[model samples]
Target: MDHSIGEIALRAGVTVKAVRYYSDLGLLDSWRAPPGHRRYDEDAVGRLELIRRLRALGIDLPTVRAVLTGERTLSDVATARAEALAVQIRTLQLRQAVLRVVAQRPEEIHQMSDFTEFDDDRQALVTDFLDAVIGDDPELRGIRQTLTPELPDDAADHQVCAWLELAQMLPDAAFRATVRQMVADWRSDWRADDLRPGVVAALRQRVGPALAAAIDPASPEARAMVDEITADYARQLGKPADHELRTRLSSLLETAGDPRWFRYLRLLAAVNGWQDPEPLQPIYDWTRTALRHAG
Candidate 1:
């Protein structure tokens, strides 16, 4: 049977005013009563119910009208609305994290300004380091220029947190100097050529068994392993495997093997939506400890 507007409202669990609004919006069809007052059919009652449910989900009236009029399908509208809500939720969560950080570390409140004005300072620091190292060599410069970590315009809470921690760590004068010196050493032709090949060969020929057995870096086996690896590296670099070279190599390994650099790479991988490398710090440290003992 046909229903009056009030009856439709009661059945749809919406106010009479809301039903009238829907009718005005052309979302609910109505027919003339005996005296031309609006009357609705069972279909209109069902349509009103659908509109109420969608409105409860924060769907705007225009979109609800579009869905009701078949200008947009329900599935498409629902998917769009879900995606919009997800973005809103993420934005709110980021704001909460920012506020929490500000409240807990009032001294670092200056950092909050940077979040709004610039990309994370850690990203800038990394960029500066790459530029300094590769600036002179056109071929290397091209590669370094291409190495950008595309952090999101609106990053998630954890990513922002990681960025902040990284920024704080890299700005210390000692840390910056250490990084610069390491980069300079690596840029030298001899050290640059020797790095990957020499390290890999040394590990394979000398430390393979200890690495396989997962020997602790401080263990006696690790010491012998380091000595063998150092000897191999010396031959490869054409340096005498003496006290000075051993000391230099040990220091180089420690600086280059900083956990922050690994962490930076991991975060950069995330920012750029790339696959992260397997962690290398443990192996590097094992190699370092072995070298120290050998020296």
Candidate 2:
């Protein structure tokens, strides 16, 4: 049956103007009426419904036309459209996160720069911290490379959050010095070959008990533990476990005990999604306290 544009639009649940627009676009075919009005065939209603359905899905007019004309299958068009929608959703989510951060910290608005502004200062700080903590040993160097967090050029909201947390930790001078001293002491005593077999084993045997007993590092009990451990270490080195050795080991424990160093590690772990190291401060403090009285 021949139908006027208005009749087709009513049957298809589309506006008259929309039907005319689709006819003009050759998406809905129409013929001339006797009175010079436009007429559409019954098939135009079905075509109008297809166009409406595709448009509702955010498929652009051109793509819709290609699908309707059979140049591309509906499945192909749908797959492409789904991919495009996914990308748009991701962009929107990132924008939402940025806005949330800005709203939460109005005072820190200046810190929110475009992702392109992720500069060398941030990169260098991250590199330096990893080096200080992990050291320059060849084995650790490879681990450092693998664990490095490279801020993306166009970071999403989560990456920005990680970057800000990492930046704050890396810039603390006290934290840097603590890490440096710890690394230096560790390197002086243990080579890569001896790390697990000697140093780790010794620390675990001697310090692990104090750590487990919850002994205060600065108490006499902790001192006894340190003395026992240092004596063992001295024997391994074929040297006397004298006062000098005790003092040196004490210094290592104290430097490694700093909470700020642990804070740095915690921040790095968070940024890299690693499991947190056990809290060592309480045990280390116990060791320090114990060492003072043991002398």
Candidate 3:
């Protein structure tokens, strides 16, 4: 049976105006009844349904027309639409994460205001900011690699929160200077072999336990921890584990041990969905104190 535009629209779940528009766009074909009203056969209803489905899936009208004209298969149209929708979904998700964080801290809304226009390349802006803080120092290549934020397309709230927190720090001149100075000092000490890889491992492995135990930094056990680390440092420096070495080592840690860096590490872990090592600043502080009196 033939159906009028109104009846076909009701059956196809579209407005009469939409049916007329689709007909005008050659997306739907209809015949004129003798009474001069537009009429569609049953096949028209199916075509209209296909058009609705494609449009709902974010296919553009031109692409939908191509699908209707058999220039592309339904599968091809669907695949293209899926890819486009995926990009849009990611964009919306980023905006949603930004807006949620902004809503909670309305005072910081200005921080997110301009970001609304950012596309998926927004992560590049963050990387650029990090590069400015890190500079072109080749010694910090590893730290720079680790600190780079690569937010997953399907990032959860914690990851987004990590990004928001990190983004907030990018413009902080004090924070940038702290990290820059730490990197510079680390590089300077690196040349003299004052800071070495094994030293950090020893501190983390030996001093970490004492710090966790809350042992007094001036206690005998603290001295043992300091001795273990200094021994490791002395091996790296090819020097005796003397008071002078201990003093220099303690100063190195004190200068590089910014609590902000600890926070940065924590936030990076959150962004990467890694387990937190807990806070390391406390351990560094305790070890620095212990190193001073290890004599």
Higher-scoring candidate on TM-score, 1 or 2: 2
Where in model 2 is the C-alpha error above 4 Å?
A: 113-163, 167-223, 230-261, 268-277, 281-295
Q: lDDT of model 3 at residue 230?
A: 80
- How big is the positional error of residue 157 in model 2, measured in Å on the Cα after superposition? 11
Winning model by TM-score: 3
TM-score of 1: 0.56
Instruction: State each model's CA lDDT, in order.
Output: 0.71, 0.70, 0.77
Residue-level lDDT of model 2, residues 1-295, one tens digit each, is 9898888888888899998888888898888978889998778778889999999998999999999889999999999989877767655665566676778777765665534232466567667877666767785676567557665444555566766766666657776677666556656744222233466556666777767776667676666667677677677666688877667666766876687766656655655566776766665566556666777
With a 3 Å backbone cut-off (N, CA, C), the pairs that clash in candidate 1 are none
Most lDDT-accurate candidate: 3
Clashing pairs in 3: none
lDDT agreement of model 3 with the native:
0.77
Error of 3 at 273 (Å): 3.0
Global fold similarity of model 2 (TM-score): 0.58
